[model samples]
Target: MKRILLAALGAISLSACAQAPGGGQAPGATASAPVAKPTVAAAQAKAGTPDARAIEAVRVLNPKVKVERVGAAPMPGFREAIVAGQVVYVSDDGRYLFLPGSGGALFDVQAQKNLSEDAMNVVRKQLLQTIPRSERIVFAPTNPKYTVSVFTDVECGYCRKLHSDIAEYNRQGIAIEYLAFPRMGIGSDDYKKMVAVWCAPDRRKALTDAKNGRGPTNASCKTSVNQQYDVGRRAGLTGTPMILTAEGVEVGGYLPPAALRQALDKLAAEQAPVATAKPGA
Candidate 1:
């Protein structure tokens, strides 16, 4: 099942272009930041099984990397693997791996979607579902129209600005579920402050105060701040105030009350199904 769409990558010379899933390059293209090419010796080092060979072949392209799965890609003559959170295609022969797209951007023109991003979001949604509500500092109305998970830092100016307007956000029926992401990494002052914020009694208030310029005091307890950090990184977090809508689109940085509401509403409308009239009508 892994080999069917049989267009060779690393070259744009092929006459019959296979509609692609994704990959790194077209043949003879220069990689300014070239990935280390996979070696046949490395391929032969693997134990029996073609699937096993394919997996190792993909891995050696970016050695020691963790991938979601190595499976049959939509492209013929290639296999797709979610390596380091993006889609890359490997040749069935265990030799070449690339991202198939024009100007280094992978896409499906017929579908009008970035096939690479679409593939990554599948795993993103799966990871989002695994997050426990208990680990988050949540602010919501009795019933809410939408919920957004935010990866935030108490120290980021934008994050602080967003938190300052928390009440107005909640009033708009936007449930703000916060997962801690201290910008300075674990063990920095900001990170310790976040751990303290998570450990504090009345965590919601503590978080709000920290964001509102109140300093963190001594506190300690078992908490999910570290785990939340890991989750945020895996979900492709590059900075604080990153928000994920229910529909899986990433809303980076801060938005004011009305602006945030507008964004959320737009996303909801986009995901909503169209109404249909009855057959006889």
Candidate 2:
């Protein structure tokens, strides 16, 4: 799925990064034809790394693009900002914005790496790591093997169906860690109802009941519903039941129990670390 665009045109306007994360950088993974590095102001580049002014410049230029974090790009003289949850590089002076979103343009010559998709995967894994187990509404068997974090909406038909098969999933040793994602947006009825579910005294039962068409007894109390919704958005959740392997591989949609287990099995195998042969063996 890691493809180069621009001899790689046929470019779609939309940049949806999905699929297995990129492997080790490709051979000759180095910055291509060198261009002149922009002349950065001495005070700016040296002050606190990705200069505040540079971040402000990015914000000023792309007001709509949500700038999460900014730092030095793989290549010198370029500042990288995690804009709108995608990796983009801004020239040192902050005039040019380099995008890896356009397919293979992602390769960072100096780093011998793909900055776009590869960095996205890295970012995904990092963000996922920040989530503590206590924040998740988990359903697992006594003995668990694999775990997947799912963004769910109680009102979504597919979400409801997924929850209906929770037991089968548990039997297969797949733990379902649920996060609230009210697709109807924060103020709609779905959001309030889900908030109630999270606020309920018996969270596990409340989640099950809500998914099964029962209303949550209490919709009061501060809950992490809002924060979870934000996380879902950053994770590119377009719809309910957006499943992801523990490795941060996005499992597109609802897969029947068997298929889901099979998918997870393949994912686990893929993520399994290779054993280095013993010197004597």
Per-candidate TM equals 0.62, 0.59
Residue range 99-139, candidate 1, lDDT tens digits: 64442334342333445555657766777777789889999
Q: In angstroms, how far off is 75's CA in candidate 2?
A: 18
Q: Report lDDT (CA) for all predictions.
A: 0.71, 0.71
In candidate 1, residue 122 scores what lDDT?
Answer: 74
lDDT of 2 by residue, 1-281 (tens): 22232222234545455545775567888857865434444233455444554565555543444456666677888776655555567666654555554343444333334355455666566667777788788999888888888889989999999999999999988899998899999888889889898887787888888888886734678878888888778876667888877666776679998898887777678668999999999
Q: In candidate 2, which residue ranges exceed 4 Å CA deviation?
A: 2-117
lDDT of 2: 0.71
Clash counts per candidate, in order, are 13, 9
